[model samples]
Target: MKDAAFGALLAIQFLTRLPVPLACPWTPATRRWAARAYPLVGLLVGTLVAIAGSLLQGLLPPPLLALALLSLWVALTGGLHLDGLMDLADALGSNTPLERRWAIMKDAQVGSFAVLALVFHLAWKGALLWALLAAGASPWWLVPVIVLGRLGAVGLLVAVPAARGEGLAHAWQQSLTRRDLVLAAVIPLALSAWVPGGAWLALGLAAFIIVYGLAVRRAFGGINGDIVGAAIEGGELWLLLIAWSWWSFAMA
Candidate 1:
């Protein structure tokens, strides 16, 4: 019980900007267990964001509300996934050898590719959120979307070979088991079912996970922390796109 409590703290610490006051010893064993709690962390993030979205629903214009929500979303996660998405874009856009691509991702400075990718990603996400909210989709849709995103990360961490023999991805890769994979997949699918027209959302997320894992394997030789991060961001966008489109069709 105590271990589970600490694992939850580790998950929150690793996944969000929230200041968790629990101090626990770090070990490979601990990290592996903490990985199991990733979906719960996504739930917390989504719930908070959904609550905020609900509160701001009619208080501001859709564009302004979306921008505010987007800012809050980034602030909550400390832009961790966004940074990963940018790093992955920079590495993929660079027509260099694998080692050099890895180095590019490690560099702190943002490149033109990263900048372009970030702009497009943020713009698309903001527009999608705005459209969905304006169309009267429930704000709680975020819960499934965010959970699916984290599950994507967990799926890759368990299934894909590590790009290199180091970093957070590699560490999780070393520790992930078959049971971990099953639990990760099952929880997200089950949670997704609670939303309207969620079966399609689940299908989209599953497809994204499969495609993303394979693409990461082909593109960068295997998955890394950046790629895992990219998977989360990419999965979220895919879910939102699919969900928004479905909602639009139903409304029409």
Candidate 2:
């Protein structure tokens, strides 16, 4: 029980701007439980955002509310995953050799591709969120997609070989094992039974796994922390797009 509690705290500490009054010791057990707690971390993020969005929905217009929510999301995460997305984008956009690309990923500076990617990524998310709000969708509707998005990271981290010998991605890969996946997947599976269009969302997540997993393996030699973060952001967008696509079709 204590392990699980600390695992949850460690996850929050790593993934969000949540304050933990105690220092979490990193160990094999923490890693195992942390991997298992991935979905819960996402759930905590989603629920907080959802509740805040719900409360503010009526007080502001859709566009303003969407921006506020988006801003809050960034604040909560400290743009951790988005930074990974931009780093991966810079590496891919450079169109350089493997060695050069790896160097770019390691470089602390942002490049043109990173800027472009961040712009487009934010635009897309904001637009879709505005659309969702304008369409009278409840903020609660996003919970499952958020869960699946973070869960996607766990899948990639487990399935893909670490691209480099050092840094956050490789270290995370060191801790997680195949057995950790059992607990990681439990929440999203249960959510499938609760959220409308959820079973299909599960299929959507599977597709994300196959597509990004293979893409990273082929393009970058394997996955890293940036790739996992990129996967989380991309996974969320993909899941959101899926939900909207199906909903539009249903209305049509």
User: Top lDDT: which candidate number?
Assistant: 2
* Cα misplacement distance, residue 217 of candidate 2 (Å): 0.7
| Deviating ranges (above 4 Å) for candidate 1 | none
- In candidate 1, position 98 carries an lDDT of 85
Candidate models: Cα lDDT each? 0.85, 0.87
**Regions of candidate 2 where Cα sits further than 4 Å from its true position:** none
- Model 2, 1-252: lDDT tens digits are 888888888888878998889988888788778878989988998999999998998899999998998888878889999999999999999999999999998899999999999999998988888877787678887889888888888888888889779877788888888778877998998997788788888999989899989998999999888889899899888887887776667544
Residues 1-252 of candidate 1 have per-residue lDDT tens digits of 666677778888988999998797566666766787888888889999899989988888888988888888889899998999999999889989988998999999899999999999999999999998888887888888888888778878887889789888887777778787676667777787767788898889878888888887888889888888878888998989998998999766
* TM of each candidate vs. truth: 0.96, 0.96
What's the true lDDT of residue 191 in model 1?
A: 82
